[model samples]
Target chain A: MTMNRETLINSILGLALVAVPLIALGMDEPFIITLATKVAIFAMAGVGLNLVLGYGGLVSFGHAAFFGIGGYAAGILASHALNYEPIMTWPFEVEGTTQMIVIWIVALVASALIALAIGAITLRTSGVYFIMITLAFAQMIYYFAISWPAYGGEDGLSIYVRNGFPGLNTLDPISFFALCAVMLGLAMAFSAVLIRSRFGLALQGARQNSQRMTAVGIAPFRIRLVAFVISAMITALAGALYADLNRFVSPTMMSWHMSGEIMVFVILGGVGRLFGPLAGAGLYIILEHLLGSSFEYWQLPLGVLLLIVVLFARGGLVGVLAGERKHA
Target chain B: MFTLFLEQLLNGLQSGVMLFLMASGLTLVFGVMGLINLAHGSLYMVGAFACAAVAAWTGSFWLGLVASLMAAAIAGALVEILIIRRLYNRDHLDQVLATFALILIFSEGTRWIFGSFPLFLSVPEFLTGTVMMPGEFQYPLFRLAIIIAGFVVAVGLFLLIGKTRLGIRIRAGEADRGMIAALGVDIDRLYTIVFALGAALAGLAGAFVGTTQSVQVGMGEPVLILAFVVIVIGGIGSIKGALIGSLLVGFTDTMGRFLLPHAFATFLDPASATAIGSALASMLIYIVMALVLFLRPSGLFGTEA
Candidate 1:
């Protein structure tokens, strides 16, 4: 792909997302920092979903299960650590963890495992079947979370104090924001690399033609299963950070509404485009801020804008500004 | 023990019928239009809200029910003409997103008109009492009525889609839209009617269900989720698949909810038992779906694509 006006716009968007947050920090605008933190976390979740939704041609409506799983990982671990309880006792007695790195690893692994199970079953069917099956799995987890009261049940789990990174003062908004930004940056880089990798090609090939991909000796199922697992892992990381940001994790985090929001970010930015999630997340937050402040019923107008975008802007905001969907 | 089991069976049948009401229209729309409508639930919600509002005004449950059907069918038609028609050619992602947007609009729109609090609709007086079975089993008359209504509609729909010219047109349209259009069937109008018909069915479900559960803004969503599960398990395009699937789901869910906690209670502490039992019970239908998909990638009645 040759660089053009779209590429330029993409670069500006990537830089703007990171720079604006830093600027907000420098200017001591705590609210902006918090908002930027939200943007980064949501964008990260979108990037995770983009792997399967855009590149692999999977439209999962149940990504919130992974997100919620990641969230509960953090909340459960932190709670257990605070209250001095072992997480798992019979299988070698695993204790609770308060460290961010440990929490993220646990979140990633737990989410990947769940994704593997869900993806294995769901990948059998394509189109609407794929969509609904994934949704069913997510709802399974959502209902479980709501009913299982060990942590909090209908009322979500809350962290009394922020879980700590190795050296950072997480209590400070800027520090937490910086941590989230770094993870978001790493995930974005991973997305760029994965899309251009041979595995990425195989995944896209399977999406385009299962027959040809099969003839070429690539098992589309295996490729998608791996991609789906990885996608869930990344989204799970974002879920952990989001829970930390709010210092609370609830069934709401895993609700279908949350899954929709994550999808909206990817679509709004530009599916399959580098930095689309970032741009989408930023734009969505900006819209929320603008419309929310002015109107009592902002969701109505937001819905209208979304309809207009889907109807007219096939590529999305990133697509509109950058370019239409082109061959990768 | 027999009566208890019988009551669970009846409960399952009652909900199964309501689910069939929701699933038939959804399957019909999906089978024919190849459209995955997320806002189908919103139409259901619309039916309930309209029924409740009108019933309160008219002070008659029967009137409310009619109002629900009219309001839902009209809303469905308008949505089809205005929004869904343009979406026929787009990818599934676009359809999902656009309909998802409709959900937000419809939800907030309803909230805008009616407050956040739920509205109640009483079952009509004549249907309020319970009927005694042969030996000490008493079944609620209203539930039995809903079951009867659901079966009547099922029979009516089967005949409508099988015995009539319009049904043939719909079947032909499902098989090949282009071929039907070439035969001078006015495909666009047919599509609109099919969509409205599906919406009317969903509206009927919402109205029927509203009499039992409170009418609220987001109430249609969980039912929508269940309906989706039913269609998938039954196969997306088959009405027979939908009926069987709904019954299976309804039975499994009701039985699981009723029996699982007791099974767990015999072993674990009541607190943990209830929690874990409820969790597993809620997940039981999905487990059933996964198993079904494992055996048949396309549902039991679904044609393999």
Candidate 2:
């Protein structure tokens, strides 16, 4: 008569997803809607990272490369549209669109292509080498972005208006939150589906034992590369939303700190868990809001808390709240 | 061209020595304990801060240097006992996270202590002037002193690792941790000493640097990345490799920036030349790394396959 963990979790998550927005609606609180929207976007980024880091076992320190690329994709496109210039032209004219559908797809594709290139070079090494190489590559990109004067460089590009959605006015706070929620839901669904698929199983297998996966007739490189690309795409989607949220995008988004923070979010949420990123993001935002509001030097306290978590609380917020699942 | 080459060579050697100081401790810690302490840089920062603060208070650079090394070593030992001991069996990701958290704590802590204002330390009077060389060129005595100091440390470390009884235990532990454990060596104590020694070396590098430039918060980060690059280019666990790799990186990085802009200026406009050259200069070492990896994936002198 007892329900299984999977079904119970699915039901609870499903309910919470619906309940959170509804609760915000009932409260009629703009602040709650804004908070929920931030959580949704960050969760999307976490889900993206979980694909490569959690499943593929690729500890890519350069993921912010994709995240920043995605933001720039959105920024450059919109700026081009605003200024009536093409992003890149061939025989056919290219134009930017405000529609989330076009924006998201373009961002995803741009990031994936870049990820493919970076992953190809970096995936050659394993272990600490991989971590540092990816980090170096990411720093290279960050520096390039900082030095390049076009598109605002270090100061960054700002969006004057929220990119449009066909049926909704994105300038409205709740409506914007709804847009992020829908994207987050879709990203979560995509991740769940991807992990359950044959490719996902193989990717997980590669992480567990790459030699065994190869012995079974799978090239771990190709599988990991694909997973890395998909992971980057998802993070890129979040980056687009994040830029839109702040109405600005800069080299800081591409910074090594941002990359570190993204990795921190994944680990804090419980690395392979479905709802972990959401939980982690929610916890992080709340901590930042509360601690940041309370003191001039709140980062000192936050650093201590993170140290405690890393040292003592290995499973993170989601793992503590739920329970540990075997590292997939 | 000869004068330019000589200047770059001296610059390269100076840069190499600074890197050697940082990389030696990093490689030693990695070789012995098999721990990647990203926070080795923080100890460097600590040394710089100590040097700057003490020199300012006491007005003796000599006293400041001594304080820097001792403070850094003590801090390193404490961190090792308190936090890093717990991380020995944990995943590398976990170690990285914990150390990264330490960096945040240390950086903010220093900022709090130092008030974000960069502190300056004047060079000692004895090392203040330039030494004349052939072809009417001159090099700063302090930079030359740094190179000599680094060479002295290198020789001392070689002696320490090769000659001392503790060095034997460290070597034995690196070769086979289980056998050393079975031999009843205090592995934990060995690890603590190794970590502290590495921290001391890092601290020395910082103290030396502080005398040359203003000591500031977050100064260790860029140097940390470069140190990582050095070890990767050198074999991860080889001290000799760290020295060679440091020279290679230091030369390439400095020379690339100097020569590339001039080379590019011949073909392109000044603005474009500056942009492209600086970018390429920054990327040169990483490019060298990629090439090295292509030929030997383990690195130039790495023991691992």
Worst 10-residue lDDT window for candidate 2 chain B reads B289-298
* Candidate 1: tens digits of C-alpha lDDT, residues A153-223: 98999987889998899989989988998999899899889988999989999889989999989999999
**Best-fitting candidate, measured by TM-score?**
1
* Fraction of native A-B contacts kept, per candidate: 0.75, 0.38
DockQ in order: 0.82, 0.56
lDDT of 2 by residue, B1-305 (tens): 77877888888888888888899898888877777788988999999999888988998989899988998999999999999898888777887778888888888899888888898988888999999878778888898898899889889998998999998998897899889999999899989999999999999999998778779988888788888888888878888889998999999989998898889999999998988888788778878876777677667888873
> By summed lDDT, which 10 consecutive residues of candidate 2 chain A come out lowest?
A1-10
Residue-by-residue lDDT tens digits, candidate 2, A122-154: 777787778878887777778778777778878
Cα RMSD of predicted structure 2: 2.5
Model 2 regions lying over 4 Å from their true place: A1-32, A88-100, A326-328, B1-5
